[model samples]
Target chain A: MLKHTPFHDFHVQQGAKLVDFAGWEMPLLYRSILDEHEQTRKSGSIFDVSHMGRLHFSGKDAVTFLNKVLTRNISEQKAGQSRYSLVCNESGGVMDDVIISRDVKNWILVCNASNREKLVKHFTKVRHDLDLDFDMSDQTEGTAMVALQGPKVIERVAGVLPVDIKALKRYQFESGSYMGMLKFTIFRSGYTGEDGVEVIIPAKIAGMAIKLIAGKTDKPDATIKPAGLGARDTLRLEAGMPLYGHELTQTIDPLSAGLGWAVDLNKDFIGVEPLRKIQADGPKRRLVGLELEGQRIARQGTPVLLNGQPIGEVTSGTMSPTLQKSIAMAYVDAAHATEGTTLAADLKGTQVPAKVVKLPFYKRAQ
Target chain B: MLRKKAMPDAPKDYRYLESHEWHKREADGTITLGITQIAADELTDITYVALPKVGDTVTANQRWGDIESVKATSDLYTGVSGTIAAVNNELTKNPGLVNSDPYNAGWMIKIKPSNAGEFDKLLSMDDYRKKTGH
Candidate 1:
């Protein structure tokens, strides 16, 4: 059975085309994917991301337990702060990429929706074996998440909310009440590489708050529109954010995927040994971004060629709505992964010429 | 696959296949083939279209071409067995025409019917509509 979010009716009312995504019925687009993607880059847009998983870890050993399992250091995070971390298996392969938010008494971990059940099962096994005092609770069912993203999201959101969103630094969050509902967390963080906010609110009161927040018009700059998963993919692809199944998987190690910054070697984590070895002797394949010469878009599973020989495969590709060019992310031989290196992607019968550009094809001008 | 949905505006005289392919018989006894509007919408911006060469024999329900969109790759199937008479050469330069006029200028191929009997086996426009939940 497909699960529906509380915002399902709202999306339909907004003329969204709903699709089955990661076991949940979610909107693929409210209007044209091109319009939504362009609006997000030129102005701002809102997304219903309630399908993502949310886990709350509390008790005295919350920090200790997370630090032991996650690749990033959770113990060093200050209150009201969020950090990107990777959950890895014994071989240093990334299970899923998550954001760990540390509050006063509990640690909130936000992960990919598809990995939620599997992550919970993995956590249960670990909790039993480690004999820790940490309590893991699945709070995804009751949470309604929305992302306000773009260059003008800050001003758009500040117009409605009573709090000054500018005061909240990146990766920082604060609790606020909207429409008499005390349950809310406004995080100055988003998947798109832009100035944006992700709001988590109680499921029952989400519709009212979403209407109030998105209904207002920024007259001088019409920046906010409802975006869907289609826009989400293009926006994140331009921003160079790695999707779990695409750039990362249980079989790929974190260090090879250009996520070494998130790993702290000083701390001993669940997948430390393999990571240490991989760090010492660099990984065979490196994830890099490709900028195709023409409008021909490469696709996932398309072979990456170096001098007419297959090296690696493309994980994700799309026509960047903002750049108006074809861009893709692929894993290639480390030697040819450097920026400016020449490569070709076998797109059906033709091999499209491409260059290894920097990860993000578009970055928010701050 | 393009789910069969009822498009009341769609020409009821034509028939459709489950693979989202649509076929309409002209008064001249030739079959004009193209993707439905709903199928074209699902594909968004049609970038490149790979069509079968003219004069090639195609079987009923067999794939005749591939449609490449910014979002995904989808197979274009033959709704009826026929010999390829002509291909939409304009789509190679202006693929967006598929989304703009899928029923007319966006017609992918013209097939010379090999088995005119296959027409009876296809779904009517109403059946196609009900199957797609349109």
Candidate 2:
């Protein structure tokens, strides 16, 4: 059985087509993927990301435990600030990508839904070594996460929550109350390449809050439509972001996936040795963005060919809503991975011509 | 290519199938083919269409083409055994025509039937409705 979110019925009421994705029964789209995608790019859209995992760490040695567990340095982060981080195995391969936030008394780590149980087990085993009094809890079941994205999301969300959100910089969050009834944390961060906020609230009041936000008619320009995982995939692809299972996995290192900037060599952390070796010897294969010449969108695991020989495989592909052209990301042999180089992606029996472009196929207007 | 208006009824001119495909017997021996409204509604907005070669022989109850949407992909089955005569090339540019007008301009393929007698094996309007659960 697939897990259902608190807003499952609300999605069905709004004409969403539901499908199972990574064990969660979520909406694929309400009406049309293109319409929802365009709406998010032009104005705003709301997504029910409640299925994502949230874990809280509270202990006297919280900072010490985090420094040992996370690849990025978490000891220096000021309270109320968040940063992207990674969990890796001893071999220097990525285990999971996470966002680390420092609260006053505890540290909050948000992880991907599919990796929740596995990550909990990994952290449990390493907890005893840090010499800290810490309690780890998976708060995903009781939390409701909603993302309001696009340029006007701040103004629309600020009308309801009691906080001066204007002062919140990117990746910064603060705890605030909504309608004097619910306490939650609002983060100025989102997966989509847009200005947005992700609100984590109590699961009980989730449906009511969504209803209230969707019912707002005074903000005409801020139209809130329910988006599903389908649009979410396409949106993130256009932004040149990597999916955990697709572009990122335990077998691949961050350097090969164009994420070298996230690693800090000064910190002694797990997976540092292999990462350093990969940086020195260069990765066998590198990830690249493909701008397809035809309309047939490449799919994951599709073979990439150069000079009629298989060179790599596509990790993610879709018809980009922002660019209107077919776009894809794939890992190919480093010898053939260069911007402006021509490649072919085998789709079924046909080979579609593609050009190796820079990372992002679509960029938000400056 | 001209767009077809949604008729009040499935244009009485075309033959219907239980699997929600439409066949239009032309003045010539050839026939034009497309998916019906029921099938289009089920498939939603068509993203890509893959049709067989023009001269390939298509057997009844066999796969001739395929259509894909964001969520699902379904094979286009042959209702009558025939030789591929022509295909709607416009669909390459605008596949949404399959969703907007499935009977006329959205016609997928044209066929020169080898066994015209087999046409009787397909469903009528009443039988098609029952088979589609609509």
The DockQ leader among the candidates is: 1
Q: What is the TM-score of chain A in candidate 2?
A: 0.95
lDDT of 1 at B52: 86
How would the docking of model 2 be graded? incorrect
**Model 1 lDDT per residue over B1-134, tens place:** 12223352667788898777889888877788988888887887677788889999898988877887878889888778989988899988788788778888989998999899887789998888778877
Candidate that scores best on TM-score: 1
How well does candidate 1 score on lDDT at residue B65?
75
Minimal lDDT window, size 10, model 1 chain A: A214-223
Please report, as a residue range, the 10-residue window in candidate 2 chain A with the lowest summed lDDT.
A213-222
Q: What DockQ do the predictions score, one after another?
A: 0.24, 0.21
Error of 2 at A313 (Å): 0.6
lDDT of 2 by residue, A1-366 (tens): 999888887776676767877799988776667766777887788998998899999877677777777888877799999998888888877888898998877788999988888889888888865556788888898988988887777777877678878889999999977667887898999888878888888999888878666554224344776676777878889889888999989998888888887777678877888888898999999999999886777888889999889999999888776786888999999998999999999988689998999988777876
lDDT of each: 0.86, 0.82
lDDT tens digits by residue: candidate 2, B31-55: 7889887677566557788888899
